[model samples]
Target: MLLVVNIGNSNIRFGVFEGDECVNSWVMNTKPYKTEDELYSQFKIAFKNYDIDINRIKDIAVGSVVPHLTYPVRKSLQRLHNIKTTLVSKNTPTELTFMSPQMGTDLYANAYYAFKKYEGTKIVVDFGTALTLTCVDKNGEIKGVVIAPGVITSLKSLIGSTAQLSDIEMRTPKQTLGKDTEECMQSGVIFGFLSMVEGLIDRINKELKEETYVIATGGTGHIFAPLTSKIKIYDRLHTIKGLRELYITQKKEGLQ
Candidate 1:
């Protein structure tokens, strides 16, 4: 069994993979101040509840965008299971070549998995705490990336900053013209982002002068993916799957 952990700014996800199949998964809030012991305890409870034996986990792969939580997570797994984790980073050996060394490991995983699974040029749009678009060419080289405020992030900011506005459930608005305040906010937030994404995809296609497969991932991918025909695929677990692939590659190359 392989355990893959993705620590993002908003959430930390754990995926248990048996060979190529992911058997189970879990998510927890990202608390940067959490100690190793606290993380170990959380892991123990989650594993027990899922009936997954800690001893059966052969290897662990971690990709963390949150710097403060990375060491604690790695140390927790080490202390709990006595297994050293393979942390995916920009330096990690993979078939994909990164354009910049500062790109997040999570983005690398997204691009690597997309490059391996799809043909031609691919653009990965991840809608997590931040909205990121990573472009990978057919030659397995990352071209560049675009980062913007995520759906929830933007919504929260708007609600937080405004004195008269309050939080509302995010959903697709029925029409471009909003009838009420909530609907107005929804239209501005959801449809606004939807247009932004579609426009970006179109712009990217124009810039490349070729077809590109756009894969959407992350927390709110499902919401926006179905609304837009531009998104070719939507897989929330894309990053963890990529982490699993990286782990396999590292093991094969004797790096792990």
Candidate 2:
């Protein structure tokens, strides 16, 4: 089994792939102070819950967006699997063109997977800590990336910053015209993002002079996926799957 870890700003996602099939996955809230033992315990608990032995995991692949938690995660994986843990980056073999060093590793995973898995000009919308819009042409050349405030990040910022406004459920209100404060916040956050997504896609299409395949992937992807007209695919597992594919390719090339 291949263990894939996508360490994001908000959460750490773990996926266990048996051959081509991802049989198990877990999401852990990110905490910088989390010890290696704590990390191992989390993995062990997930393994036990799924009846997957720790020893069965042959290798590890890490797609990290957080730098502070990188060594800790790799160390934990090393202690558990006692095997190689590959760090995925732009350097990893992939179809998408990488030009910026500031590009997130998660974006690389999404871009490569979209170009190889879906095949063609693609726009990947990631609704995570930061909403990331990445465009890749049919020839596997990356067009650009647009970054904006993520759904939950925006929510946290609003709730944390405001004096009167409190946290509300992160769900779309039944109507765009909210009735109460809760409904109003939900409407603003949810519907506002929906509009932003579609509007941006339209602008991107105009710039590209062509339509592109759109895929949304993230913890909150399902929320915006149905509401947005541009998104055709919603798969939360996209990042981990890309990590798995990257590992396989890198291993073949003896980069691991």
Candidate 3:
């Protein structure tokens, strides 16, 4: 069994993969100040709840965007299972070439898997703490990326800044023209982002002069993916799957 962990700004995702199949997955809130012991306890509880044996985990792969939590997570895994984790980074051996050496490991993992699974021009739209679109071409070269405020990130900022506005459930509004305050916020945030995604894909397609495969992933992907035909695929486990694939590739190359 391979344990894959993706630590993002908002959440930390864990996947237990048996060969190419992911048997189980879990998500937890990201608390940067948590100690190694606390993290170990959390992992233990999650594994227990899922009936997964800690001893069965053969290897661990981690892709972390939050620098502060990386060491503690690695330490927790090491202490609990006596296993060293392979951290995914730009330096990790993969088929995709990154345009920026300093790009986030999570993004690199996303692109690595996308490049392997899909053909021709591909864009991975990840709606995490920060909304990101990573473009990779048929030749396995990363073209570029587009970054914007995430759906929930934007909503939180708006509520925090405004005097009267409060949080509302994120869903597609019944109409583009909102009838009430909650609907208004939902309309603006959800529909607004929907347009942004579509417009950007259109612009990117214009630049590429070819059809592009867009894969959506992350927490808010489910909310927006169903509302648009532009988004072809929505797999919440994309990042973790990528990390698992990266681990397999590294192990094959004797790098792990």
Best-performing candidate as measured by TM-score: 3
- Report RMSD for candidate 1: 1.2
What TM-score against the true fold does each predicted structure earn?
Answer: 0.96, 0.96, 0.97
User: Candidate 1: global Cα-lDDT?
Assistant: 0.90
Runs of candidate 2 with Cα error greater than 4 angstroms are none
Better of 2 and 3 by lDDT: 3
Which ranges in model 1 have alpha carbons more than 4 Å from their true place? Answer: none
lDDT of 2 by residue, 102-202 (tens): 88888888888887888668999999999999988877788899999999889999999989999888887999888999999999999999899999999
Expressed as tens digits, the lDDT of each residue in 1-256 for candidate 1 is 8899999999999999987889899889885568888999988898899999999998889989888899999999988889999887667798787758789989999999998899999999999999999999999999889999999999999989999999998788899899999999999988899899999999999998987999999998998999988999999899999888877788788885
Ranking by TM-score: 3, 1, 2
Q: Per-residue CA lDDT of candidate 3, range 116-189, in tens? A: 88888899999998999999998889999999999899999999999999999887888999888999999999
lDDT of 2: 0.86
lDDT of 2 at 132: 90
